[model samples]
Target chain A: MNHRRKVTVGGVIKYIVLVLVFIFLAGPLIWEISLAFKGPGDNVYAIPQYLIPKTPTVNNFVEAFHRVPMAHYFANTLVVVAINVLGNIIGCSMAGYAFGCLKFRGRGFAHGLFALAMLMPTEGLLVSTFLLVKSMGLTNTLFGVALPGMVGPLNVLLMTNAFAAVPKELIEAGKVDGANKWQRFVHICLPQVKGTITVVGILAFVASYNDFLWPLVALSDDSKYTLTLGLNRLQGTFYTDPRLVAAGACISLIPIIVFFAIFQRYLFEGLQAGGIKG
Target chain B: MARSVTQPQGRGDARNAPSARRHHRAIDDDGPSSWLFTIPAFFILLLFVFYPFLNTIRLSFTNSRMLIPGHWVGMENYVKLFQSDQFWTALLNSSLYVVCVVPFMLILPLILASLVAKGPKIIGFFRTTYYFPVVLSAVVIGLIWTNLLDSRGLINSIFQSLHWITTPIPFLTDRWLTLFSAMLVTIWEGLGYYMIIYLSALANIDPSLYEAAEIDGAGPIRQFFAITVPGVRSTMTLILFLSSASAFRVFSEVYVLTRGSGGVGGEDITMTMLIQREGTGLSARTGYASAISVVLLIIVGAITVIQQLIVRRGDD
Candidate 1:
């Protein structure tokens, strides 16, 4: 009976700690959500710090949209994300298949090139990359924002590992049936690595959606600003009011949350299979 | 193809036998076509990644402006960089960021991971909720924390209501306080990410070892110190390197908190911010910024090399 009490006590303590952590981690988000819905009549700086707005409304959201071209920014971000996802899917998968399955000369050299590219800090190369994009006449363009990150070395490697794990028997069987290389790759190898493909797609989407630094450097025009940049502008403009800023932030965050909720399982799996393992 | 059909071999011996070799040669004769597959990716990498890197090095020597391609200045930019007060302050702030932020990142996440590693069905829910911050853009995170740490914000308001102090803490106004506040944001944003990495590492540790420790009357704390610490040591090292490197290159948190001013009088600037400030805009000193970029590269590269040496030493 004493031991049972001790176990229960331990479990209770564990839960207490967990709850504290939850409050710390998710508190700001909840506060932001509350703040976004707060009407002008609500005292945002209340002494007790209410987690729910007394007079809940969508005025802040509407105000945020008016202050910035929120829908235009969203549409621009969507285009950039689509280009990135499609580019990474086609580009990385092909490169990955070549590296993983094909026995070709200078393969080691090609792989080394990718490894070197992976290690080059994007922060360090911001200037010259901007110059390159400018020289290509793609400055202030969505394509320029999407171009540099479209085929990341990490994704290539992730897809390579996935392709390498495709059973040899399957490939051999396809070869026996006189299927060409592309035929075998598409029919045999690609189907086996659907999970990795989804993971790659999700990763590409998140990276592109959340990207701010490169876009800041690439596009100088306000009309071409992505959601992150637009929200930053909103914050800069509306420094006095937290409500509109919160609403702007929420606008940028909701899609990511929805996307994450749908595909979070694959994300964790991808982290295990690709990130740490590599 | 005929040879593969006639002399079927096991997967293991296929690499060794001459017949299997012949079969592989016939089936895997995709030399030129394979090169075709890799072309598109390499083209992008070369154009965007490789060329720009080479160009940055070359541009550092020239007195290049944003529009006009200037003549070679021969280390003038580097000389100017070393003499600048802004460079020194930025370097100091970035170094201080790594020092203050990395320790919390290493420990907090490990503890968080252990707490959620084993539990009831609700643990999964906790894990998912915790990762919410990681998925949010850094801009959003910066906005969230900036409001919370504002002078009349939720935290200060709560403290004042409780009579903790008369005046609100200058979380984003004071120079050093602002730097530390940004570091706090970094840690808060990173906790879930590193926790996920730790969870994976924790999963790899042998369960039998824990059972053995339990049988020997070792308590949870004892087992953690003896088994768990050693088990996740490599992961700790990885987190150490990752956190430190990221801390050194921190931009968005400080950038957003200071509203792109890099604190009052630009006292809390970072290396990347310095690069951005100099290298961008119509009147950008591209040459000088390239020089800063080169310095940034060297420091980050040194960190990586030092980390490798430490890992090798630990292995030895």
Candidate 2:
């Protein structure tokens, strides 16, 4: 009875610690939300910080939207994300089919290349990639920003792992029924890896949406600016007032926040499925 | 675009005949058509990734400006990079950042995962909140933290209200404090990401092991170190490699917080920032940038290879 009581006490303590950890993680964003809602006259330096504002207002968000072309930036970012996500899904799925499902020569070499590509710090490739984009007359264009990330090595690897998990007999059955390799992939293998494809697609979606440095460097036009670049510019413009900048940050963050909330299960499930085992 | 081009052909094939093509396969699946599956990715990778990689290496030998080409300087770019004090400072700061950040990123998540390993379904909601920052852009995190770190910001206000300190802490300004402050931010951001990895790992462990351990009168801590840690050993290595690699490439945090310096005194400068500065600064030397990049690639690549070797060897 005493030992069981000790176990119960320890469980309570552990639960308390876990709750504190959650507080530490969620505190800043909660603070940011309060800051965003503070009106121009509210005391930001309140002696006792409050998670909720004294008099909440949407003026900061209005100012954030007014300070920059939030709509334009959102549309531009969506375009880049759409193109990159589409490219990663199609190109990576195809590459994955070849590497995972087909018994082709040079497959080992190809897989090795993908692994190496996955590890190389992309910051190292920035200068040359920028130069190449420039030389191709693609500067100030969204496509230039999207092109380099289109077929991500990591996504390709994840898709390969996903496709490999599909029963081999399915593809062989399609092949025996006169389906060519392409048909076998399109009709048979693709459906099996749909969940995984969604997993990789969502991963790519988050990345492209949040990408900053490449878009900042590759595209010089305001019209081409992504949400990060636009929000940063707004922060620069509203240097003295953090409340307005917080609003901009909230704007840029909401979509992915919504996305993760909806598909949080997929992210957890994908890891268990070994989508990133490579 | 890839779908548009490939889908129509598949439809065309389907319309032609269903039974005629059966059993008439080209003797083997390893026909010339295999290239059709791999070629699109191959082309993009060759055109963008490989071609520029070669260009970067070639440019390292020559004093190539962004727009103008110069004569090959042999090993001068590498020589200058090795001797630069700036390079040493960056190397020290980056190394310090890695030393501080990677361990926290690895272990804390395991603890949290174990803490909430089999709790009620609401753990998902808490898990989402923990992982929230991972999805947020680095720039936004930078901004949020910057607000909190300001002289009269929330942190200072709280500190003073609690009588912890009379003056506001120079969280983002002091030379010595900047990297540590950045490390704190990193720890916060990484907790959720690595937690998910560890949680998934923890889920896969046999519940029977814990039940058996309980039968032996083992406590939770002993059970963790004895079984849980060992069960997820490979995951620990994976997170270590990932966090270490990212630490070596740290940029957006420092860039946003200091508006491009470690602090007011320019105490922090990462290798990535150095490459950007050299590549695009008024000095405008692609050769130097390439050399720095090559060094970073070598260091990061070597670590990557070593980690993979360990992981692969374990598999063998």
Candidate 3:
């Protein structure tokens, strides 16, 4: 009885500590939201910095779109992300299916190479990647921005693991039914890993949307800038007005957050499997 | 998007003697259809990954500027790269940033994960809140923090009102403070990612072990040290290697914070940023930047090897 009482007190203390830590971790984002909604007339430099506005306005959001081609940038980012998602789905899935279910002479070797590809950081290859795009005449285009990243090593590994989790008997049954290798994969193996495919899609979506350095290097003109580069430009343009920068940042974070919430189950499963890839 | 068949829970190889033999036979009967399926990935890999990897090595030996290849410089660029003072400073700054931040990146999240593991009812809320910062773009995080710690930004605004410092401190502009601030942002953004990883590791530990410890009157801290620590030992090692690699490659955060010029007073430049400034654009020194990259890769690879040896020994 005494031990139980002690645990209750300990539990209460733990809750208080965790809640405080949570706020500290989440405070800046909340601050971004509060500051973003403030009207331009609001005195941002005033002491006792305000958390909420006396009258919140959409003027900052309006200003964010007006000062730049926010709409065109948004459309441009979507086109690139859409193309990347499509490319990774087709390419990574085909590769993952090959390695996962099919046993070939060099399956282990090819898979090992794929894993090595994932481990090797992109820093060493940036110069050639840039030169490759230029040689292909894709410099300063959205397709060029999406091309190098179209098939991720991580995505292939993810789909392979997901498909491998399917029962061996299922594939064997398809083989007995006179299905060819491709038919067995298409008819039998591919359907089971749909959740995993969604997981790969969500990962690709976030990676594509949040990508910075490559886009910065690939696209030179303002018209081709993604949302990330556009927001980056705002740091200089909105030099005096920090409120507008916060507003632009807030707007850009919305789609990814929505994707995260809607596909959370797939995301968590992918994250669990992700530790192995790491 | 297509649902062909649904298997039951806990699906794995169903052991039937007849089917097991047939499975092996079927695998042998399939020609090289597997390679056909892999061709898409291979085509992209040839153009993007493998070619680029080999090209980077070749580029280090030539004085190629922009896109055109030039005469072979052999060891000239490598010699200059080693002799450059700026390269050494960037390397030192990167080493300092890693040393200062990687420990916190692993341990702080671990402590938070243990906290998250304790509460059942509110676990979902805390988990989401902690992960919020990680999903955000580095540009957003860099901008937000740059503003937060700016001279007239949120931190200084509060400081002035409280009568702390009459003059706003230079958080982003100062030489030392600038590098320190970059680490601060990196650590802050990294916490959520590692916390979630640790939380998953914590979930795999047997709950009965803790219940048994409680039966013998072990406190939470003791249980954490004795049970939780040992259980997640592999995860800690994994994070240590990963965070070190990322810290060495730190680029976008510094890029946005410094407004895409070089680092503040050139003191906050990391290996990736140094490579970018030297290797890209019309005046690019392809050979010099490639030499720097080779050095960076060698360092990262050495750490990985050392880490593997240490992990293997620890396992034994």
Candidate 4:
């Protein structure tokens, strides 16, 4: 009976600690959400700090959209994200297929090139990349922002691993039936690794969506600003009003949250794969 | 199905075929088309990654600006960089960031992972919630924390009401406090990411070892040290390297937190910020920035080499 009591106490303590951690991790987000819904009459600086707004309103969202071109920026971000996702998926899968299944001369050397590119410190290369983009006359364009990261080397390696895991017997069967390499790749290998393809697609989407630094550097034109840049502008313009800034943050953040919630399983899988290898 | 018939045939072929013949077959099977498959990715890597890297090194030796390609200046840029006080401050700030942030990142995430690793169904919910911050961009995280850490923000108000302090803490305004505040945000944003990595590593540890320890009446803490730490030692080292490297290169958090000023007198600037500041815009000192970029590269490379040495030693 005493042992049972001790176990119960331990369980209770574990739960208490878990709850505190949850509050620590997720509490700020909740507060931000609360602040977004707050009406003008609500004292944002209330001493006791009420998380629940006394008066709720959508005015802040309206004001945020009004003050900044939020909708235009959102559309701009989507276009960039589309280019990034398509580019990474098509480019990475093709490269990955070659590295994983093909046995040609200099294959190891070619693969090492990708590994070298993967390990290159992007932060250190920002200036030169910008210069390269400018020399190509792509600066201030969304394409410039999307160009450098379109084919991530890590994604190529991930897709390579995925394609390699396709059953060898299946490939042999395709060969025996007189299907060429392309046909076997498309009809046999590609379908089998749909899970990994989805993982790749989701990773590319999140990365392009969340990318801030490159876009900040590449885009000098206000009309071409992605959502992150737009929000930064909003923060600068509306520093006095906490509510509008909170609402702007929510606007940019909600879509990602929804997307993450839906595809978190695959995201986690991709993250683990990338994390381990990287 | 035809697959069943071909499976044995494939096995027989594999058995009958010598390894040399298989290699020749594979080469013939791929042909030049395999090279075609790799072209697009390689093009991007060469054009964007490798060329720029080589160009940065060359540009570091020249006095290039944003538009005009200026003449070579020998080692003048490096000489000036060594003399610059701003350079030292930025370097010190970045190093301080790595020092302050890595330990907490190493310890906290492992504890979080272990807590969630084995528990009821609800623990899965906790794991997901913890990862919410990871998905949010650094901009959103910066905005969220800036609001919370503001003088009239939620935290200060709570502290004041509770009589914890007489003055609202200058989390965003004061120089050192601002850097530390940014570090806090870094830790908050990174907790979930590193936690996931640790969780994956923990899953690979042998369950039988834990059961054996439990039978021997070893408590959780003792078992964690004796079994869990050693099991995840390599992972811990990995996290240490990852967290420190990222901390050194931190940009967005400090940038957003300071609203692009890099704190008063730009005291809180990092290496990336310094590079961006010098290398961008019209009249930009691209040559000087390239020199700093080379410095950044050398330091990160040093970290990686040292980490490899440590990992090799640990293996021995």
Candidate 5:
């Protein structure tokens, strides 16, 4: 083929492939949104399933809200998210500061421990953690679900990368001015990595909010279930009812999507920013 | 944000010079305050991660169960797990998932990052669309896909209407299809996360490398292999290990989609699900579950070490 023809053909192929790929990616989601608006009697799985239902209603959503106590779940998740974010920010940056700025004994050993901690999968610790929580009478409480996730070693690794990016001169200047460690951290280090902090905050929020396993194991009571656990329950109970479950799924996902979009700039920047140090 | 001048000012105080020396010595003796500040984090991690990991190793030897103290079972649980078909099946299933899903998840994210990174102003919209799934937990994704794959659901409906198939396929109900179903949902959830990682790595790749490759008359595909892949090798290894680990630890999709029954032909229950089933109050096979968990830990640890060795060899 000639160059112009080949270019046009490639362009067409790219557009077509992109469009098809987009459809595949978004198809299930679009279908779920449609199912949420479906009426009670409609056979949601029936042949000729309407992409736009003949009789759209909010009944599924109403039933979902009543059955799941979504507000309570939301409240529980919010509290869990808040605590997790706070812990990550303080714990990670503090640890990161030690790793990045301070010369200390066994620092390499300590850093290796943090890396090993990141490598240890949560499943391996599940049973023992459950036992420990049960023993402490923390089971079935919000604290139990949120507590284990608070100080992730990965956060420390991430923040250390962020913290290390602060110029050595900055820390040295603070030291020369006779600033105490805490003062240096708060006044100098924190502001320099504010962007990293914001990124970590969003990531922590997303991870904690959508966390399923711990919340499921820790809180047996439906009243204290996070949105994730609530979604699981909704699916199990309404197995045959696609509309209600889809509605429930929509409710669970919308808040997160909204939050992420609001913080997209920070989220994107955070991903790249942490890697720059490497 | 003003730097504190108190310590130096005190050091310069001639009237209290001896006391100042003592104070400076005390401060020096205190050493790194960053370590002091991080004590809360260390304490919490020790109480949770380190202790629980040690406890898992200990508990694996005993028949611990809910509402009951475990008796020492020696290696019986491990032996039983070896003999059990269920344990092998779950192991195979999880390994298959890692093998199948890791490449797709890793490669697709790299492709996506490259494409979106090069695209114009509309990149954010495409990114948001792709990443929208990352916000949904596995349960929600499972529910939506389960419905869409049901016999009378959207997939069959569209197919049937278009005469693509004469009959509805049992997507989730069938064993082979169920694994793919899980993979589909998993890939959706995983893509955005790795995409973020790749985007970060991509940003760090010096543009001059690509420019140099371009001046050498290297095409896009050649440049991608030569420049982009090599540029992002470390990040790729990090993501690959993490993705593989995650694949091995899946529970939510299995729980929601099949509830450990393994779907139509008993092909869906992963190792984590098996442990979960046996550990719960209903069955209470704590020793058996603990053995399974220990094996899992060993498998993951082994794979991780192997991966590190392989990656390190390439680096050398």
Candidate 6:
């Protein structure tokens, strides 16, 4: 009877803690979402500070879209994301296939190089990269933002591991039927590793879409600004509408929310497959 | 089905067997094509990633600038960095951030992951709820928080309403509170990601161990220490190294919040912020910034190596 009472009490505590945790985690984002509907003149803080705006409207959204060329930012962002996704899929998968299936000299060395590259954070190399990109005459171009991310060491390593999981018998059988190396890869390897490629593509897309520092450094003009860069310009040093700022911020979250909503299964599966140990 | 479309390509290779065999024999049969295939990635990384890395190290020795020419200056930059007070202050500030933020990033996520792993009933809700922040860019989060923390903003209103404080607090522009504000933002943005990682790792752990522990009358807390902790040690290590490295190199939050002002009397100045100041701030001391970058690089490298060693020894 005492143990039963203890269990019930414990259950209650768990539920309370989980709810509080969710609130704390989601509070700021939810607050920003709420402010999106509030106008500039409305008191951002009314008595009791209405968590839900009473007079919600889309004017703020329209103002943001009109003031900034939202479509241009969207186009630039989409172009970069598409290129990054394609590059990451092809480059990482091809390299992953090499490391997993085909044996050659310096395989271990190449793998180690990729791992070391993964450890070198982008911040550490920002200065030289800036100069390098400048020298290439690619500064202030979308290519500047998209080029460096063309092939990621992390994706290479991830794909290598994922490719290794495909049964060697499958590849050997393809080769036994006189299929060439390219044929074996196309026929036997690519389909088996589709899940890894999809996951890597999604991750690359999200990261490229949200990246700020590199793009800010690379792209100089206001016209080429991605959504995050454009969002930075919305609030001045002082004397700006916080509600409009909040509303503008909310717009950036929509694409990510939509993407995750669509591909959540692939994201989780990829993360689990990639992060969990054999 | 899409599956059938791919099968024709597989079947085509089988149909053109003789020609495919000829093509295979014409090329070197030792699979040197594997190495050939890896060349694009190799060159791309070498030129962009590795080449820049080497150049940065070289520039650390020189008097390089953004807009002006520079020449080799030997170890002068290193000497200056060691002697400068700002260098040490920034270093101290970064270390403080890492020390304070690392534990919360690890522990909070671990606890959250455990809660979600309890059952599938609430898993969907928890996943989306936690992951929602991970979707927002750091710039967006930075902008939103800056508004909330302003003197006349929502936080002050709430505090006043609750009678917690009689007057508004300068949360962002202040010295200590500014650092705390940045820490809070970093934790919020990062918590979901680490939680997802822990959840995945927890999911991968065999459930029979938990069942065996229950049979032996082990409580949840005890089982957590004995089973769950050990199971997730590698993951915890990875997260620790990544978070600490991120903390040491923090610039975006500091930049957006304080406008690269650091703190009152420069108390909140981080090494990365100082680098930015040297490069583009009114000073535009390019050579000096490069020197600062060298020092920052050394500090980050040393910390990463130390963490890696600790993790390795613990694993052994």
Top lDDT hit = 4
Q: lDDT of each model, Cα atoms only?
A: 0.83, 0.77, 0.79, 0.84, 0.74, 0.74
TM-score of chain B of 5: 0.84
Q: Where's the lowest-lDDT run of ten residues in candidate 1 chain A? A: A269-278
Stretches of model 1 off by over 4 angstroms after superposition: A1-6, A273-278, B1-28, B309-316
> DockQ numbers for every candidate?
0.48, 0.39, 0.49, 0.49, 0.35, 0.34
User: Tens digit of lDDT per residue, candidate 5, span A1-278?
Assistant: 34443555645665676566578778888888888998866667667767887688988888999988888888999999999899988888888777656656555566667767766777877777888888899998998888887887767766666665677798889989999888888998878877667766876887788778778778877888888888777777445577888899888778877886688766555444321111
Chain B TM-score, candidates in order: 0.89, 0.88, 0.88, 0.89, 0.84, 0.83
Model 2 chain B scores worst on lDDT over the 10 consecutive residues at: B3-12
Model 3 C-alpha lDDT per residue in residues B29-142, reported as the tens digit of each score: 356766999988888777888898888888888888885688798898888888988899889878887898899988998988888765456777887778767767899999
| Angstrom error at residue A209, model 6 | 1.0
Model 6: CA > 4 A from native: A1-7, A269-278, B1-29, B263-267, B280-286, B311-316
lDDT of 6 by residue, B1-316 (tens): 1211111111112212223223233343345667876776787789878998788788878877776667989988878888989888888888888998899988988988887776546766876688667756788888888877878777888888888988789898788789889988889888877887787678768999999999999987898899999898877886787788888888778767775468678778887777766654223556667667767777778767887687657646
TM per candidate comes to 0.93, 0.91, 0.92, 0.93, 0.88, 0.89
All candidates in order of TM-score, best leading:
4, 1, 3, 2, 6, 5
Which candidate model has the greater lDDT, 3 or 4? 4
Top candidate on DockQ is 4
Model 4: pairs clashing at backbone N, Cα or C within 3 Å? none
Interface RMSD of each: 7.5, 8.2, 5.0, 6.8, 9.8, 8.1
Greater-DockQ candidate between 2 and 5: 2
- Ranking 2 against 5 by TM-score, winner: 2
Candidate 4 vs candidate 6, lDDT winner: 4
TM-score (C-alpha, index-matched) for candidate 3: 0.92
